[model samples]
Target: MTETAEQAVQFVAMARKSFPALSSMRGSGGPAAAAVRSAAPMASHFLRRRGEDLLMKAVQVETEAGLANVREIAKVEGLDMVFFAPVELAASAPRGQEAGLLLALETAEAEVKRAKKLLGGMLVPGRSAEMMFAAGYDLVCTTSDVILVRAAAENIVREAKPPATGPKGGLVRFVTSGREAKFARNDETLVTRLKKSRQARALGALVRLGSAAAAELVAASGFEVVVLDHSRGAEDLLGAVALVHAASRAGAHSLMRVPALSQAHLRRALQVGVEGIILPGVESAEEAHALVELCLYPSRNLRDDSHAAEARLKNQPFRRMDFSFAPPLVEFYGQRVAEFSRRQGEALLIAAQVDSPEGAAHIREIVKVEGIDMIFVDAMRLSGADVERIETAAKKHHRLLGGLLVPGCHVEDMYRAGYKLVCAASDHGLLAEGAKACLKAERPVE
Candidate 1:
């Protein structure tokens, strides 16, 4: 046999030696004597009489049938088996099977205990690693290929992206004393600033260009706000957090357009501390109210002090500052929850899109909804008359009018039409256009 295989066999033999055969247990004294007596039944569950050869094998399972087979083998041998059932397998198993397999493993674990045999459960990396450890298994398996690859990828991404530093969230105009310092920006928060600044005409950037580097570069380019566009592209919570932090560290305000009006997406965006959320395709006052409720909380109508928001703080990237949000082994997360809650729509901008005819039709009612701060018209989708109606409604309700202004749409016309926060071009649009221009320049026409 190869050296590694020889070592594995030697190790298995050593393990087997610890539990003496049932016939010899009476002679083995001390703690082991008692252990052997209790563990003898376990030996029978694993070993089978195959003429002259004995097989020592471990069960590595991801399915119910596989686990059941191991359980049956252990039962037949009367010696407990040290089975390896990875947590990832249990989690990815069919919905009901995931729970069922875990329970079955737990049941097999109990049988092992009864027979005084060995049972060690293996677990993969994820939120479940801690859960399985806390479940009181005898041996906790180390990281496997899944975890190694995940960790490696995360490390590479972190290395490629710049770490967040300095002040985070909102704008800060620092003032200094002889030894100490304090400062303030506009009394209006980012949302309020965008809402009330009619003549501000602050240059803003639409950050559809993903990656932490892109976000950081855009934030440093002197934009008043970085609107993270997820409506047209793919974005995850972690990426959004990175963008938000990068924007904040670069002294720019952060906003996000969620994939949709999803509670999970809204909560994650809020927890990551986006200064605003632009809800797309809002059609009615009721939908506006619901969106607003999801955006704001501690209000009379809606609240979510759930762990979903608080748990994001558990990760370092989502922490409020350099200091930890979670206290050392304490259950009181109220303070942390309150910290997240304070960033709600009232404190941040709650803008909605009047993109379709249905949405434009209810502009007046939608604008009147409490907590709705900005009404953005999708210039591409809405007609000139429709844009006019939305603009009129926004003006009447004293809400900010904002939208995406394409090439043909005059920026001055948008401003004249009372659109305060206008995105003339997005990161993707700029890059695509620049590439096309470069190609045309390279092959000049005669």
Candidate 2:
């Protein structure tokens, strides 16, 4: 089997453990779903190959004759039949995006049902994941890798930390800063939006597992930001690029939570289009300052400006979809990129995770460091008093505060306690809870 086929097998093995009765799970044959979260360059590749490869290969190859041959081979090989629809053909279609998708869905559904094979809709768009499952898709693979790893990482962190007291362990009211209020009225960033409208309390989904398709789906749900948690999830440079691109395509801002304060991690994340980076385990003002420097270009130190720096600095400007310039304006764009690079520390947000007592003690000083956008405390790592100290320091420094809100922790209380950014839940948490609810409702004890 090909490497892609092997991944499908792994997915099948993983799925069977959850639903023993499931006979088999198939992989998506189309490139879009196959490539959605696969790597960063996949989208550009697909776009460039629109005329020949996408149409001829995807649409034509997934025909009845081709599928029948595959079905026979699968039976001979003792494998289950998995049908892939030509969803990628939607982009190459003569019709518009929506019309292409509707046509492909109708055609693929019929073909897969006729052959008695499991329909595999790779990279289901928008809220179509829910609808596909409801339409009786045996198994739907929304995303994989980083998302799952992050879920496990978060669970481990939660388990290792101190448990909360009774529900609503510490309650405090949160107020937006004057600067935040001003930004809300002017900037399009997630922070600004949340501040502008109290009712616009933005909810974000953390992609712990490296599923760009899943991230895209979450983005479709109207989240202001989608966080790719590298601190707890299994992700490398390529995976981060894919997740960030996918989130942006789905109209959501992307944030990456790095494991530590490192230049390599920060530089790569910025290059790949993350709007912000969350630095976990920040314990001192010096460390916080260093983290900010890592994210910024042209720090106080003297360094030669190389051709590579120019190219990478230009990467940020290319992030905007409509960023086009005239041939004569090339020099102007270059100057803009150069200036943007110097002041990037001010433009890009820096978030620090304070999960240790040492970090809590230095919270005031850490917040004083410029570019430290928000401070998130792990509820398990800090007690009521510890939280109070952090809150007091935040007020003094005039910085925004944030935290992780697990179950039984009252959201209102956290807000009252002055948490501007509270990650109430994650993708894996929601999935597990939803599954348990389904099982409980359908399979009650006698």
Candidate 3:
């Protein structure tokens, strides 16, 4: 044989040796081709699972018998994702909970053949079906088993007694801070899916973005909340307005962590549609009080414009609108027109971060301040003693206590430490980790 032919033969041998599974999957034609075509939408569904978006609604099936229940569950509108649970456990669920357990295997749009196409295989143990479901929501949000058990737990909770704190809806929220990206771009396919996921995960994570185009993808990829961090020098506060719009489109609970405690910054953030503010370096009750008042729409302003037209603050001189006259407000106005104080009107949330020793000393006083919903201790900055101090104050005041997700620490540990809300590492960190993981994956034999 010629040298080139010998090299080609070696390459073919290596390719066959590397892709043993591909040989089994070689005949993915006819029915499989049709399955791939039909499952394209399912592929998009997995990618679109955004942080602020709704958890893609799913129902469970355990056995062939469960297929009979599938059509019944599909009746629930907007129900898309489907997972399979262990029959022994799922059989115990009561009727009300059953609505959430059953999923459609065949429907007006889907036949059993089409449903099989989406999953590609039955979700038995060690099957890829389970993995497909895990990727249904945020990879960090949960695993496939958690979804199955949560449903069963909810059923048990409902049967035994009423929930201790209602249905923990929107309780397990994640907040991710944005890092300055020198070159931040995501896959065009992923960007498209992120847009799709926004509509569903609209209520997920709070995030900060560095720029608009690429950073907007950060907002889209399930971390819908825009965290306008101090370090992200995006021209001015005005630039953050577009970030807020992107977050809004994603249906995120937008929360900004400002550079400094400026009334102008607070006003601009709120006007653009920030649902919450994370006040950093909070020290005293006086600071907490100022943060609350400025965070609120002026009660007096509603009575009449008078001096309200001038949106000027003590040192800040720019005159701009204070309240959010954006689409959310516009929708509210369309429903009913009324002038009322924000004390009774607005649903905005205010969070104070205790990062300094002075803040620790005044934690009790700060918690006493009304209008605030959470007390965040900067666990990354403070000592263990400081976190306990802030946590005690938070529990005493019935306010949610939050902190950063410490490296190498389990989220369960943070919860046990009495931290209800935990901010994850920066987006850049996650991206770096992902890149490292991708590089670490073994390639096919050469």
Candidate 4:
């Protein structure tokens, strides 16, 4: 049988085993539950290899000791691992602006290079475009908090110029500054001063541009996966789509975040052909089932048949729908949901948006959902006290917890807290800004 057909058959079998009770839960819940049970096995079968081959086996390393800990985890996790190295080690400087920051950037870049050479590929959080592009890391995660910084860096780079020429056309002077520095002849005081000032204002712009450029470069260099950190709105969808298209063109994999899993947003994202969906705020099995149902071809809700036909004609997969649910409730309903998703042959992801004091308890319950393939933690909702609790719970359960944040949050902070995936809000400028941010976030840092 063809791979797709074989997958469908496997899904049916797994559904039967996972949700025997699905037959009894008649009504809206019944079908959804059955679908998930059915789909889980098939989804698992397809995803297992991909997860093993492409998913970054991220490790949180704060120091050399932490690196050692990560190495141990890699061994236990099997082969082809990627570590999310600490941002402080990779981005922060020990002292002033003179050499410390530069040293830090270089160190971070070297560390990533070393890891990629040793581990085959790894994920890393980066501050500068140079570090991110130079390191050759597999994936790079960005936080909403740093958008301004990114924009600044891009602007600086854009304004930079080659060394100026003297009256006789000899080289005049070279300005060595951040990534934005420009070169000009000593005689061209007026132009250099204006350029320097302009560069200062464009610092944030420069960073943003650099981030995007870095993503393009990474894809061109032949990375396997690119994930974007988008937490707020749908603005990042286009950027995500662009990255996906670019990566696909480059023969790489691309993934992005849909701030939430609404039907409209999910459809739009799927239309763009994103390989994965990072749904935030999922808390229950029923919700998980609902998401799976949405991912299926016939979808729980009716869709325009014409659109499906068109997608097929264009060689595009039909868009999958997604559902969101709060916690505690998913625990009781996840199995049914998994069954329904399996029967339908769709992709489903469970997002754990831990915003309340009871989030840890809720996550503990969520981990038990038999067919849940992935888990996302809404860090924006999670308080400082809840970080360790949630991390420990997710780890013990062997569930993947993605980190999410609003604009201005730190990717390193989330990584340090044990979040392998980081999503940031996409709304800042236009809807396209969010879209672009999503794509850039997903691009591997290397």
For model 4 the local lDDT of residue 369 reads 55
Model 3: worst 10 consecutive residues (lDDT sum): 182-191
Candidate with better lDDT, 1 vs 2 = 1
What is the Cα-based TM-score of model 4? 0.33
lDDT for model 4, on a 0 to 1 scale?
Answer: 0.42
lDDT of each: 0.61, 0.57, 0.49, 0.42
Residue by residue across 179-272, what tens digits does model 4's lDDT show?
1221123212111222233221100000022145445555555444445545542336556555555555654444555566565455556545
Candidate 1, residues 13-77, lDDT tens digits: the string is 55566654545545556676567558676553344233113544443444454555553444434
**Models sorted by TM-score, best on top:** 1, 2, 3, 4
> Using TM-score as the measure, which candidate wins?
1
Model 1 stretches with alpha carbons more than 4 Å out: 1-188, 297-346, 444-446
> What C-alpha lDDT does candidate 1 achieve relative to the native structure?
0.61
**Per-residue lDDT of 426 in model 1:** 69
What lDDT does candidate 1 reach at residue 209?
Answer: 61
Clashes of 4: 75
Model 4 misplaced stretches (Cα beyond 4 Å): 1-215, 218-225, 228-240, 249-252, 283-285, 297-361, 404-419, 422-446
CA error at residue 382 for candidate 2, angstroms: 1.3
lDDT of 3 by residue, 1-446 (tens): 11122333344344334333321345545676457648674533343334114443344444344444444443433344434433212222331233332233223114422343222223322224345455332111223443465557668856666445668544554333231120022211111222333222112233444556534666567654455665344435677667666655654445667767775466556555455678888999998877876664333222133234223222121111122122222222212112323222344557898888889989999999876667876766677788788888888887766666666787677766665556654555656777888877855446
Candidate 1 clash pair list: 41-78, 42-78, 42-79, 43-79, 44-77, 44-78, 45-77, 45-78, 45-79, 46-77
